[model samples]
Target: MRESKALQVLKGRHLRLEEPLLLSTVSGVASTKPALIRYFDQKISPIGIITTKSFQVTPNPGNREPVICETTKGNFGNSVGLRNPGMDQALAELRALRQEWKFRCLLNVSLSANSVEDFIMLVEVFSEVADILELNFSCPHAAEGYGASIGCSSEISSDYVRKIKEATKKSEVPLFVKLTPNVEDIGQVAKAVVDAGADGLVAINTVGPIVHEDPVSHTPILQNTIGGKGGCSGRWVHGKAVSCIKEIRMAVGDDVPLIGMGGVSTGEEAAEMVLCGADAVGIGSAFGTVSQKDWEPYLNSVLAEAEARLKPGKEYLGPKSETYLAEDRQMAYRKHTVTKIAYYGKDTIILTLDGSLPCKAGEFAFLWLPGIGEKPFSVAHNDPLTFVVKKRGPFTEALWLLSLGSDLYVRGIYGAQLENERTDKALLVAGGTGVAVLPALAQQLKEQGTEMTILVGTSESVAGKALLEDRLSGFGSFTCVADDGKNGRVLDLLNGLSLGPDQACYLVGPEIFMAIAAKKLILQGMEEEKIYLSMERMTLCGIGMCGECVCGDRLTCQWGSFMRYDYLKEHAPSMVGL
Candidate 1:
């Protein structure tokens, strides 16, 4: 295959890439060992560079849960607090990745101390394995006197850059300084860093320490109680990033390479960044919005747009910001009104939406309640688009309180869907709210003329069984297992069950339960590949970007929410929870 034109010589180093689209400083997606392995192994997109999540000298636990919340007009507010596994763990992971990495990678490093010694220490350790070193002087959510605190002042930024440059002089890996836009004049900081021996610059980390609160609870939504505000990313920060790049380019006069990033989700946006004087564009939140499989298509679209504008005959004016915004708005989030709500039990409710979005049996959608926040839910039914929610946390509890006709925003249909395989017999096992996905899966299997036996394990009393039998009646043979003897535990029922060679199993429930069930089936001579398990994790974006849903190398939102038993056994053994 011919090499991509996205390749560019930066500071005498040939940065090879199929596209100028770089996975930006998304800590969740690009930081971890598993995430990086997934990126290089999948080769989903020939992205030129991948920057690891920002790390400090010591491990930072970061803020509490609900660290990320969707803002109005296609932005995401996150206060993850720069949580990273310290320098020692980070270097260890990078050293391993260096042996196998096929693409150029940058290590985004941060200093937690005011002393220049800590900065030098970080540089020396990471420079050995990093293809490029990116000094993160702009993380907004870092502890006091760190991150943007260092970048906001030109003198401080210059001093830090100079010290780092001196530290890495031996290795001489191209050093890029990431600037924070929260400064009074980003141009000054850019000029100072460039003059202080920086080879390149990544403009505009997230903007603002935006906050969100739960309306009913009268408390902050983030687990940090009253969350320290975090930077805003995604579409909202695009304009700020472009303006910063333009100013920085004007200040430095184009000699230094500039990597423009912030809310760059489309090809048009990438082109816009270039027009604003960026040599390359970085993508962060956009990746979170798409699945692992969609990475190539999404990135290619941006590359094609950038390439089209760079054509010899094409005279590139500037990107039409209005047009791009309009186009992005269409894809961001849409309003859906609740048409029906039925209580399955005291805690579980099935909501029917009036929206007509295309969705599959096992796929999920993100439900957004403006001030409340967004959460991913598997589509319970598709006719009118339904979501079955269990009252688990603040978000779900708020969702449960909503009455009919309540306005809500919905996005996605993301993740892989259950496959309709030709089997003589299929077993569907579910526990708790996991049964929500079974009705749809069962319906699909019934349509395919496959015999299915569904076993539901719930702790709820028989009265809590409300309408389940009615909903699943036509789908297949049904069995309910309550913890009480009225029924029985699913495992007890399974103990007596028999399986033929042609029998297949699909399981969705608690991690331990599924792991045990899979083990049991395997011992019963069921082929590992024939058994499928639906997984759940702290899925933030419902796409691969957030890294929250990552279970080993596989991103549950992209590679699965439903995974093959054998694949999990080999690739994500720890996730098996056996």
Candidate 2:
């Protein structure tokens, strides 16, 4: 019968909220414009505040893929390399969100600069539009001389915060410094920032630049090949967050507000943060469970539970401590025994595993061979976790020679999947091994009762033609164009087809080929939004955290593997070679 006490005043500003919960930066899910629009439109509950993904002055291409890996339940290790669309584009998107945002919003800004001027400039610019400014001083994955590089040094952290406060003096924007948990003493860092005029603090950014490896491959699972260290977040980092918040709260002595965030996934965790001296708790990663529609109910359940436990004048009890075992921190790469391997087409082979892995169409996994390393491949089939492999590099070449009963490590179900828009008809275009992702899409379309047509192109036709036909059997209408055709290019086949107003097209192949086909479809009067293409990039992390698979402003691992031509044209034209 009473309103939740989650709404509290910070720095003389009151955050009107339905509940106390705040969605932390879940990167691709919480930081993107499209994702935010959906969240606001759906009115997801406990929306005390929303924070954008950390952005810097310049566009960061990030690192190569295999950027993120789940070490255990609710634990993720990621080295995203601070990928963002730079200041100009970031400002434009922020302005757009300002116009539409009904809830309080904080812009999370990071700086990877040689001098403090860039940091000041960012603060000055963002202070004008954002309700609150979060200075990301603790991004462990940032390039050298940035993020944690700055935060770890008390003098540098103080100087940066001092300059930022001075820069925003005119705007009087509240500055919240986000600190790193990897430091020797986070409390000391917190004190330095607070002394330098930080209005608040976000305790414990991701912990550790941890590494994970594939046991079979005896190599790092991340595409960076070395398993470069990445920050750890989720359930595993919850204790670290609590300890950091406790220390900061002790250091700041209840004056500076501390926002505790790390691996918070439930209402109990939220309450635990409050008890640990957090003025407010930020929740992320947990929302990965359901769609935007379900967020309100999910948050309500979380808040209700928190409300019941966090009564007035509750005493602070220390968090329960636990030890993490080797298995707890390790990557979950399942060892699948290869049951079958057969040549599909020239240079192409289909590998069938002894057991199945749950996956969706368009999702991919890392295939690991000990001493040979691991690489990502689109799932050719789900039931038995099949992969259509091509001998493109050392990994694939090694995979080609793998005999029956050979052990391989497969981990994933990453990237966005092809969704049915309920269109009357759908056209699928595949070039080379891009055909591997098609069977799953065709099957989904068929189940949805959407008439489907597939046009596949290969450099050379061998048993591969028959192999493709067998995969698509009973799924859709199929056609093929090979180099042996009158024209050697896949684009030549698109000239004869017509896309109607009610039709949609999905393309996957070499970048140039897809770009040409997309251009052709658009020229034929197809709405750019109706045309989709799969982008191939060196994906380090299948999640958006690793900036390796960025296509212009979008992360191919998160925003797309399948993306709309119109959206790309407007936001990321470079992605489509426009």
lDDT of 2 by residue, 29-136 (tens): 344553353343345546555666677788886765456667555577676677678888888876776676454444443334535888788878876566557777
The runs of at least 3 residues in candidate 2 whose Cα sits more than 4 Å from the true structure, single-residue gaps closed, are 1-9, 12-29, 32-43, 99-104, 110-114, 213-227, 288-293, 312-331, 336-363, 368-376, 382-408, 414-429, 441-453, 459-464, 473-477, 483-578
- What's model 1's overall lDDT? 0.70
TM-score of each predicted structure versus truth:
0.77, 0.73
lDDT of 2 at 536: 64
Error of 2 at 23 (Å): 4.9
How far does residue 255 in candidate 2 sit from its true spot (Å)? 3.4
How displaced is residue 529 in candidate 2, in Å? Answer: 12
Model 1 root-mean-square deviation: 6.1
